[model samples]
Target: MSITSRITGSKHTFDSVREVLAKANEEKSGDQLAGIAADSEAERIAAKDALGSLSLETLRESPVVPYEDDEVTRVIQDGVDEAAYDRLKDWTVSELREFLVDEQTREPEIARIRPGLTSEMVAAVAKLMSNMDLIQAASKMQVTARCNNTIGAEGTLSFRLQPNDPSDDVENIRHSIREGLSYGVGDAVIGINPVEDNAERTKRLLDVTKEFIETWDVPTQNCVLSHLTTQMEAVRQGGSADLLFQSLAGTEAGNEGFGIDVDLLDEAYEFGKEHCTASGPNIMYFETGQGSELSSDAHAGVDQVTLEARCYGLAKRYDPFLVNTVVGFIGPEYLYDGRQVIRAGLEDVFMGKLTGIPMGIDACYTNHIQADQNDIENLAVLLTAAGSNYFITVPMGDDTMLNYQSNSYHDASALWDIFDMGPAPEFETWLESMELMEDGRLTAHAGDPTRFLEGDR
Candidate 1:
């Protein structure tokens, strides 16, 4: 009379679904016996005995389902449209591999599903692809193999100088630069964001940076990480800067807060070409990371990593001098923990390098996340092995102003020693000329360069 009785064909209440399933199994076992009765009793008894046995030979002889193959097909089919699914449903493994490589065919369209597709799905498809297909896709995506040698010649170390207080006077800021330069850092560029975010203060900071470069002849560039418009305003007011810096995102809306768009970025690029006096190959420095798309509510159902790659696509259009993935700087809400941070950092570097941009990693983490210096070091070593162009080196590995820890000067030194890398060619020349480097190693002056103070005497 009740729903349970109707389903079970008995007036019994199930305490849980497990009890109902157990009853159903009992009935199924009886049905199986009845079906087996069609065979001889001796045969049925032998079959039962074989199934009941735990013999190694019998277990080894049992049929094993190829669950991994089934799972890969399920994942691929799940993300594809029905029509696309139908087309691929009958494809052989060889056919699938060919489809991924056939440039003249529309097969790549099958891979262009909606953005919410999981990494597993992407990886599954990737697994089916050959190295040639992967390389072609990377090339088509405009992934770069190496960084531009304009700012830091290839294999050079670089660091950013936040200076704890952007409002610090020229002398105080000079002190920070002196310390970083003494350790053979910042050969790439000394990038700083103004605390005041005004044209006057921006110009003053640039002036101080220019003074330091001229005084030391460090053969490096400087960056002002304010809105492009602010930097342009400073330039119009007779200010100077080597690179124009901004934080960019994948989506239009995500970049709107910074008043940036592809068009605006183009305009800024042209403006920098006109105003920037640096002899570097490019003048634009853009920073990006995951979670910004979701943070701006502009993700549009796209996965964070894919959207982040889209940002790189946009960046490469301008032929940027430096592109940095500030992994873990935003916090755990997007990345969640150190494992996620490490993965994202490696992915960014791989994607960026494949996109053919001069890619770097701001291998860093916030306190709120399950990350520490060791985590950052792990990423740094991995990224270095992956051909990362540069990283952000701060004092004692802690950025007082940004409230995060990144690769330290010591870490950079270790990487140099371990990898036998040095500063960019131009910076290396200056270091050698200044006696900061001798025979491809840091001179004692690199640690205690009192030459900067000799003018006082």
Candidate 2:
């Protein structure tokens, strides 16, 4: 079908956009975007008068060697690559600064994609996109989430710690607190998902949130806590979406079990705004396979509906800069649908495109496993295309042999190095470009001993 016809077809309720366009035409139109200007080249030599006379002052000591040569210094100074050195030699300081500081030089930009196919799911995607954009716009800070629960006989786990102290594991709690505040993130979402009932879980979550705020003004570093897995009061928790809506729209509080209450969330937002000095810590729901694999259809159902709406609403409310998602808890089973994940990921990208939001993929798993390079690369490409520039997971090194399950937490730095999209320069090569004096001192001149593009300059 033709584009115009498709837009007006059964998928869309619009009978005609011609009238809308006509009305828009009748109204005033603002200034159009300016066209790119063409440049003219003129290599005209300046008259000697225009150039003015110039005198060069030689340094008191133009030592062949800029500094004292020591073994350590020599080692530090000998790592520059030929190509990089050549580039440096050709560049002036201001030019080099401009090159390094320019935004265009640092990161890959995914072009903006317009929102299409408005639906609950699309809206959610749009919101996530919006939220992600907001996050990227903010200063980068370390953010972490932690949870703990005491499983009850009803299959519903009572969230033990308040939002503030979910982890009884002192080490985990300390880690979460330190991680969040150390970088001044100051904001985080704490939630619980029940394995059984929603209402009970939510009650517990609220109780914990309240207790957390009252307990420690600041938490210890490296503490362990129970993370939330489910919230029963939500509509999709064995009931209709309507029930969830009613709950969100309902009373302020009664008692909770797991998950979040809309009223409580609002209260927390206010609390954070007033007391925490931070603006907002969002609410994110974590779900795992209820002993069932993630079918393409189920994936569609959530990505298309619940997740979409929830994120969109949050974006509209908080207008977060970037939207980050943990693609179902890290598990081997879901990896089966890697292809499906790719598809769903694409949908997320398109949705973000429409909303001008950037998204980040969070590979949340307890196992300290390194993901496959091909999978990581593909996901990175897909995410970048979808307007994401950040990832939330452990750093990784390029060890093709190191699978996610086999690695240990001690390798986090390596993992971080591998998984991160940021530019990483090798240490040894950085030392070679220095314009070294016989005495071995540092200098900024590209060929000087001090000029290391990649490292210990």
Candidate 3:
């Protein structure tokens, strides 16, 4: 059905919920590139106005991608709690927006209705929300998960030690991990993106990192961010890894481009449960971003925000331990600049939390984006305030392998200090034992990698 809005005597008509969603989204270069963005500011606001007035029932009825054709649509539609959906089916998106931001409506109330809302409904509200609105609403919610240790507990901010080397040098990665651990990093998994996707390389990387964790009895897990298939093959060959890592997309076609689908993900989840080294449940690690569908020609004429929310829906199926958006890594073509990158970082984290997934942000930008370290640092501080579960930290804010700038290992401590936060509880105890941190602050012995070296210490 068509939705139209008249604002200040100018009329704008959107062809479908898909059209309205794309137009209502905050300025994104990806949408513009797809020729789906609103042509003018008034048009954008009009679309938002139209969208806010859409009932949750309408959104539920109108799957952005049809159920018959898309596994993702089926996952979202089939997962809703019918009773909760019935209770809130008639509410307008704007009312849901108010409920999310209202001081009286805490996470419990929100959580109760969370199962009723679809990804489109979530994206619709986000389009109507201001930047602060996103942060304030998200801060009220805390979603925690466990693999090796708990993540997303209150008053804690964790970091993933992304000790990636340009080459798949096991020793080089080991050095970076030592340095990061010295700074009280790696509270989250020590995840490495390997230089190659071969099973042999993945196995070797996992072996080196897992050995270090065992030797030091570190309180975190180890993950080699290879394709799930490669990681599984390595583990089948007797390699050690605490988590299974994979990139996810919103649509089945988009996922297909990455050589994955719901079936493969389900198989991987079951495999991790049976064979992954982490204790108990929650062993999957997923990475997503806004513009992946469009970049891969699988967007189906939908907006990036809507596509992004669907990714969370898919992720929720696995109850993943860690899910982060490589928010600005997609380049200027999708996020465009610092402003867009910051907005997307906030939106992704907020949406993930609302979905009840332990969410975090790789608040980063590529070298070519109109953003710098300062912009990413600004995003990191905002994400911490927004109660993010964890963040991806590279040595010195530069990922030599990925060719991007993210938060530095040093940045995590700075954030904890600024916000009176500490690392994950178990990790904090480890840090104190290692003399890397004391009283929620880095100690004198912190930042000294030599302390971890064999006999040289």
Go through the candidates in order and give the clash count of each.
10, 89, 0
Q: Write one digit per residue (lDDT tens) for candidate 3, span 1-457.
A: 9899999998898889999999999999999999999999999999999999999999999989999999999999999889999999999999999999999989889889988878888888999999999999999998988888998899999999999999887788889998999989898899999889989999999999999999898988999998999999999999998999999999999999999999999999999999999894889999999999999999998889999999999999999999999888988889999999999999998888888789998999998899988899999999999999999999998999988889999997799989999999999999898888888899999889988896643
As for candidate 1, its clashing pairs are 142-355, 143-354, 143-355, 143-356, 144-355, 144-356, 144-357, 147-358, 156-423, 156-424
lDDT of 2 by residue, 85-198 (tens): 343333322232233234454222211111211122222222222223322422121212221111111111011111133223334333433332222111122222222334
Q: Against the true structure, candidate 3 has what lDDT?
A: 0.92
Off by over 4 Å in 3: none
Which TM-score value belongs to model 2?
Answer: 0.34
Best by lDDT: 3
Q: What's every prediction's RMSD, in angstroms?
A: 15.7, 24.6, 0.9
Provide the clash count, candidate 2. 89
Per-residue lDDT of model 1, residues 1-457, tens digit only: 1113322232333332212222221111112322311133333233222222222221112111121433222222233345533444443323433544567544135334222222222222333333335444322332222122343334544545444453546676666677777778777678776667788888888877877777777677887777788888988898888888888776566677557766677788899888885775578888998777666666544346545665665676667888899988877767767777877776676566544467787999999987888889988877766557778887788877678889876576788888787877767777788788887788878756365663842
Give the CA lDDT, 0 to 100, for residue 442 in model 1.
84
Candidate 1: residue 215 lDDT (0-100): 74
Steric clash count of candidate 1: 10
Worst 10 residues of 2 by lDDT: 26-35
TM-score of 1: 0.69
TM-score of each: 0.69, 0.34, 0.99
